[model samples]
Target: MPKTTAQLRQLWRAYECNEAEMAAIGFGPDRIRVARPAARAFTALAETMTRYRYFIRPADTDSYNCRTITGGTLKSLHAYGIALDVNWSTNPYVDHPGTRGPRFSPKPTQAERALDVKAGRADTDMTEAMIAEIESLCTATGLQLFKWGGHFGTLKDSMHFELDIGPDDLAGGLASR
Candidate 1:
């Protein structure tokens, strides 16, 4: 069935909505942005945060930036509001350190952060216990609602959660759960 205008309005409201409201409630960033579609997933993602305190800081959460990946041609999922990076300062994209010479994967800033993490400078890094809970929360939907970057073998983006499918797929998954 075709969606009603009211439904469209609600969906658009979700898409263009600002994230300040969530931050006000002590969840995410104050002014961060995400597509309405992604925001729906965010709602489900937040369900498992009750036990995990100190998980996110305003400075560490990033989303909905219109830019390319650190050093790649593909546009970042953030640009499409399909990605969110949390605790990025401590948990970085520490793919093969001192490797991939001359390859522009993460750019210089990330390279430096990766080096720092390898040197054990990441005091705020999320432990496996944290990710384990987060994993349960994100996967609760059963549609593979979110992907934890920490699971990335070489990249190790420990502070990130992102979605690949559309909102309906995520919604269906979340509903089933």
Candidate 2:
């Protein structure tokens, strides 16, 4: 069932967080939005992986929005800033078979993510080892990694990750209509 406005608001206390508070965490120029707890966790993550700071660094990924799942009805965690998308441009969301959903009509590519910009793009060269480290760091930071949409089996969203603190929706983040 869909949560009422009051319930959503109450549940958002520790999650939805104010924009000003989010700015203090040093998420870079994008001023990426993340829950208070999640932001602190990412701070630690960035410190741990100082060498590859650029990779884990938050990009211009979408944050809060309100909407149902792509084809379903439910509240998405993004409504509370619990979920964030990183490197979306380079990491495509693929909807493969076995996930019980149709494939993504137009798959994304690293080349496109590059936007034909200069060299040194994070998505340009990623090795299996790098992915593993990122996954391990994420787990250590109290976050869950959702690769290829995980069990969804429908979308191979390689560039996505969620804190798994609440419901995950695709229609839009908590703020999205």
Candidate 3:
């Protein structure tokens, strides 16, 4: 439930979070920073992933980057510390056909994903069941739901997830979806 790029630009003049507004999730070297309002949700997600044995390597996970969306000028949710990427090596960002330059390729379809699994090109840990369970935890005391990037139609950033509520909605304890 992120806002449109125009809305985001208007809401956040610089699309940057102050250090005081950020918190760390996970442990030690694997920890990632995120907006304080979303720390609880991300913590719950990390715990859920651990419980489900969906191991994520630190090298492949990222959060809270101050950057624009890839291939676009708009600021990315990461700039707001509300987005995260997990196991990026196994679940890559892919453009849909005709959406990007010819150098980019279409995202894998269900059939292609299955083939990737068979060929050891992708990991099987990010199952629908795991996603469902994580999403279900959104209503827990201090947590909020996350929208999986896999659901994007034009481009597939399967490794990404972001708070499903906006900053204002989060402050108001409301969920957009």
Q: What are the lDDT figures for the candidates, one per model?
A: 0.53, 0.44, 0.66
Clashes of each: 2, 13, 0
Best by TM-score: 3
Per-residue alpha-carbon lDDT of candidate 2 for residues 1-177, written as tens digits (9 for 90 to 100): 334434544655555535543433544334456665566544543443344444443554565555444455655556566555556655555555465432221214434435432232322222334445554543333433322232245555544545433333321222211
Give residue 59's error in model 3 in angstroms.
0.8
User: How many backbone overlaps does candidate 1 show?
Assistant: 2
Tens digits of lDDT, candidate 1, 80-147: 56567876766666666543311222323444544556565542244445456655543335545566
Candidate 3 lDDT trough over 10 residues, lowest sum: 100-109
What is the TM-score of each predicted model, taking all chains together?
Answer: 0.62, 0.53, 0.72
Could you tell me how far off, in angstroms, the CA of residue 171 lies in candidate 2 after the best superposition?
30
- Give the TM-score (vs. native) of candidate 3: 0.72
How displaced is residue 110 in candidate 2, in Å?
A: 7.6
Root-mean-square deviation per candidate: 9.3, 10.0, 6.4
Clashing residue pairs for model 3: none
> How much does candidate 1 score in TM-score?
0.62
Q: Could you tell me the lDDT of residue 1 within candidate 3?
A: 44
Off by over 4 Å in 2: 1-24, 45-50, 53-59, 99-126, 138-152, 165-177
